[model samples]
Target chain A: MQIKSLNDCNVVQMEEKLDALTSDEVEKALMGLIDNGAKRIVCVFELTEYISSAGLRVLLVVAKKLKKMGGELVLCSLKPLVYKVLDMAGFISIFKIFGSEEEALKSPQEK
Target chain B: MVQGVKISLFGNLILFLVKATALPFVNSLAILSDLGISCVALAISIILYYSIKLADKPADPFHNYGYSKVENVCEAMEGVVLIGIILAISVQAAMNFIHPKHTNMPWVGFICSIISVVINFIGAFYILGLAKKSSSPAIHAEGLHYRLEGFISLAIGISFIISIILRLNGLNKIDAFVDPVATLLVSFMLIFPSFNLARSAFFKLLDASIEESSKMEVIKLLGKYSHKYCDFRDLKSRSAGRKKFVELKLILPEDIPFKEGHALAIALEKDISRNISESEIMIKVEPCGKDCHYIQKNQRCPYL
Candidate 1:
């Protein structure tokens, strides 16, 4: 896990683990970050092997929370296989994703 | 779709005979329910087959999107049919509860239930195996239908045995409750897959995206190439079926003739295709002023 802060309340984190995220873990790690003053977050994955539906569900919940807060959550650096799963589920439009962590962080931040 | 139906129809027809004959002798609601399921399965199988064949046809001038949604529509219809069958069986079973009858041929019902369970199970497995081997949505739906049918048959069998045991214990009303409950259970199972298939097909027909991250990947990859080629002007993209459509605008230096710009576009397209095999990219070349903003946005263009 790699977490970095950018301008204002924006933060970016990367996770290389391909394991399915339990709801508790999602709430703990991601909700914890949001509560700790991350208004906008970008989760980048490098060296990730896969992202199952369970992981996707967690991301969906997180994304919804961020949206409710008027903040955005982006994802970046997805492996091909992972990308395919996201594509098949038609989630590409729901989340902001970039090819690189730097680019994702730089994308039109508010405040 | 036709092939799927024919196979299902034949198999169900055989099951229907066994169940119908046992229904009269044993007067078992479970057997009757199984018979009803077999009949519905056969009917839906036939409907789905023609629809699938039509849906799989190549896109013609009139319908550019092709007929893929036919399978989904068929699946949805089949789901509706299953729901109706279940509801009818449920109502009938409930009525039977109010007016209990003497079932003298309990032994025949027991034998029929056993045969129905075995045959339906085998049929479901055979169809599902074929479905898994081929990515035929129709077959998948059909196979699921059989699976529910098999489950219903099994439930009926258990109900008969339970009925006999309960009859001895002076609780004959138990058998009256089994048919409706079994029908309802099968309905829920069959309808769920049908609803799911319909939703997927509805989205597919609307030309939904492959995945969210893949779309972003496409945008990022295209943006990178745009900066390398020239000052990025415009980027537009869409997805249809299994292919992606990408169009990007880049301004080449005025000094570079049309031939050079065209060559650059070809090279970039090749690079993109090589990188993403599933993409069908279209890049538009535009001549820009020497003071290109892309140079400031990105340090240099190696492709240039």
Candidate 2:
């Protein structure tokens, strides 16, 4: 897990595998960033090889938190398996997603 | 490609010489097995040099898809060679098991094995880097082979040292069995990469689909234009060598003009190309629902 702040957005890059074992850590880290007054969050899933429902739950929680703050939680560079999991869970309709970090950063902020 | 093969060939030759030199002095089955595999490696490297050259040939009249399969063929051949080496090692190990001979000059064999392992490690690293950069399966397969061989050499060297130490402690019978046991262990380890190379090459030869992730990427790209089109359907994709072939069928509203549909397809292709640069895309736009008369033919129709 790595976080890099760019301009007004915080980019969180997930490591190789994100299952039940690592989901709690992911949730804590994202919550830590949100608690620090970070509004715009972009979770990069390029390096993530696998992500189970637990990981998705963490993303959903972060998304809800950002939505409450009138900010946005965007996802970018999701590997196929993760994308399918999200799509299957109907989270694709709930969250804003982009193909790359640049595109996610350029997206309009939620009001 | 030629440079990569040449480097691998020279490296394998040197490793082979090192192992072969130590084989006669040590009288160890493990060293013999290592020497035999290296001999096969030297032969395969020569074949790989030609295969790489042949695989680089552009698409011609006879071969429409170019010579990419030559790389796959070479990879499969390497796998077969490794299997043969395994078989030979197994037979020798069995023979040694029945009538074991204690290894002589164990320290010299250990030193040579270490040197070869180091050389192979460096060679595999360099070749794998080149393979990734060029996306050449032949070079990649060769690199995998060398990486496995290096580990085997290291194992053989360690076994030699262990056997020598045991011999010094007067455990002569145990020392006698060490060479064959080491050979068997290394030979079994060789199966994994050999099987992997063969399986991958076989699939590529049969024209397998591109990875699921890449296919999903195409679908995700099309999702951005969901509102513009009635629906996107029948997205198919396959891969050959480094090239990806994508066929996308999009259902458009009947009211949309043909020019607009074509423009949408072109734009979508551009977007997809941005993500998958090696993709060759074909987009077919059709009227939505019952407006598509071809739907009655019981063909692949999303709006049935």
Candidate 3:
């Protein structure tokens, strides 16, 4: 999956679903974005379903990356069952989630 | 599956006899019209039972898609039957309006309508509970059938009682007209449920996406992964009831060993399974290149 960079913020709009292999590619893409000074990225999951532990670990890495830079990461558009898994893993409270892609893009965070 | 239908079948039979037998004796048009709907309900229940049994069967070499569409077909057939019955009653009721007869046996019909209503209510509640427990489309359709029958019966009872009230004031002709008017009213009741059932069954038969929310969730997950990967594009999915089949293409680093990349795919599969139940994922891990799009779209290698 490709992470398209937004002109307005460090947030990246992911265009596909993330699994272990996909998450690795996503991590590599995030590393490139992080190198480009992209901080406090908002990840959009508009076309994605099912995130495994490997996928979660990738997100955790991104969260860690943002934390070191005093930035944040947010997730949006999780289905009830997927959201349930995230909830079970205590990820809901850890990440900021908006109801929609547009809302996640504009989620208020400390600059 | 057949057992569920048998229960509904017996319930509908009782409702029909109560309405049909009592309505003519009581000289109430509305109750008689309502009674006609019971026949439709019974027909639908029998069809539903057969369809449920068929749909519940596992896929075979002859039918790879399983038998899920059987339920939808049964539902659509039920809708058609309902429409036909409603039209027949309307025509019959119109004939009665042209030659109205004095009704002295309305009390008898009224009692019968009451019995039908009680039976329908019990049947609807029972079938609805079973539908919920089994998640069977046929059972749900059966419950809806009884529920509608119950409503029609109530309407018929109310119309007759009004006729009775009017007859006491010496407007005997008004009592004669109640049955015809009730027939027209019952026809209107069938319209909504028939249209709704037909539409849902058609959609299911077409294999249309039944769960948009789930798809969106999947999309969002893919988009999130983009932060780590690049050149990810082209995702497709189809749903078979509760099962979701997903296919996608992703770009992996060329330097990554083939074994590592294969492992990555396996890991991603696990993630998808964890997030969505009964999911199958097919991934094509491609290297970032100008020919990638062509390869995905045309399946031809420009270099070759």
Candidate 4:
């Protein structure tokens, strides 16, 4: 996982296979960004191929935390399989998704 | 659990033989009650050992849910046998009141009772520990029976010693009542646990739900993903002997792919099972109907 600042939001580049063993690290890293005062976060899932319920649980938790603190979380560059998972779980509507990093960063009304 | 039951079976057999051999010669209600409890324990331990083995059999065409309930039935029968033995002791105790007499060589009965008490207690505690590790109800029931038998034997031994001392001091009348009174007291002490075991088994026979703490764990796990789905319906849980069952229906957004919904269900099922050992779980998923607010608004689902 890698975190970098871009414009007003911090982008978290996720790893492949967000399952039981890796969900905790992904959660902690994303939550760490909020702890470090980064708001308006975007998670780029270009490298992630598979996800488990634990992974989805981490995302749900982080999103809710950010929402409660008057911040937002968005996603971009989701691989097809990962997008299908989010969509199939009915989580797509709850999160804002974009086709590219530049589009997510440029769109102010996505949230 | 298997080792615990094995120890209980052999231990009860040894105690029963010792008391049975002494009963005809001792002529004391104290000795009789000791032998009676041993007989009951031996019978129950044999049943428990086999029930543990039978309960491990997997589900087959003849039995859809497997043999787990055999342990519960065996447990209930054990309680029934204990009650039967207690009643027998009570009858014999009442008989002794009418014809009370000092026991013949009560010192022999005391020594034998003391030895059996020590052995029963050791075997009881050992089996209880094994039950905890294996989580077998049959072994737990056997352990408890052994412990109770140990206490009864202790009471029997103490009464015999009291009789011995009284006969030596020429207090014949009091010694005559000692054995009967001790039998009465021990029988009274055993009633609650016997009835308790029977009651617990009755509930299990009806397929009662899992424990409250385990149900809470299921609820807490679902709460973590509650926001992801539209609704959950028909949640239910039950237990049979050592087996726990949890089942529910989950409703998700209409556009969620069937396999994705299944994945979520499997995840939650596995999580809930992990919380409660020896559990079976089933989660069925249904897509939300057109009555949901999203469908009512006539808005195209953005994800779709």
Best by DockQ: 1
TM-scores for the candidates: 0.59, 0.69, 0.64, 0.71
Residue B238, candidate 1: alpha-carbon lDDT: 45
Ten contiguous residues with the weakest lDDT in model 4 chain A: A61-70
Lowest-sum lDDT 10-residue window in model 2 chain A: A61-70
Model 3: number of clashes? 31
Q: Which ten residues in a row have the lowest lDDT in candidate 2 chain B?
A: B295-304
Native contacts conserved, per model: 0.00, 0.00, 0.00, 0.00
- Model 1, which residues run further than 4 Å from truth? A1-111, B1-5, B102-104, B169-294, B297-299
Arranged by lDDT, best first: 4, 2, 3, 1
Weakest 10 consecutive residues of candidate 4 chain B by summed lDDT = B295-304
Q: Write the per-residue lDDT of candidate 3 for residues A1-111, one digit (tens) a residue.
A: 436556445656564556645777888888777767777677777666677655665776677555445456788777676677677666776678888767877667754
The reply for model 4, stretches above 4 Å from the true place, is A1-111, B294-304
Best by TM-score: 4
DockQ of 4: 0.02
For candidate 4, list the clashing residue pairs, or say none: none
Q: For residue B38, give model 2's deviation from the true position in Å.
A: 1.7
At residue B139, what lDDT does model 2 achieve? 88
By summed lDDT, the worst window of 10 consecutive residues in model 3 chain B runs over B295-304
| Most accurate candidate by lDDT | 4
Put down candidate 3 lDDT per residue, B1-304, tens digits, no spaces.
Answer: 4666788888887877776677557766666667667777777777676666777688899988677667767777887778777788888888989998765567776677778788888988988888766656667877888888888878877777887888889988677888788778888988889878877767766766535444545544554554444434455665554346676676665555788667776766666656766566788888755333333455333222
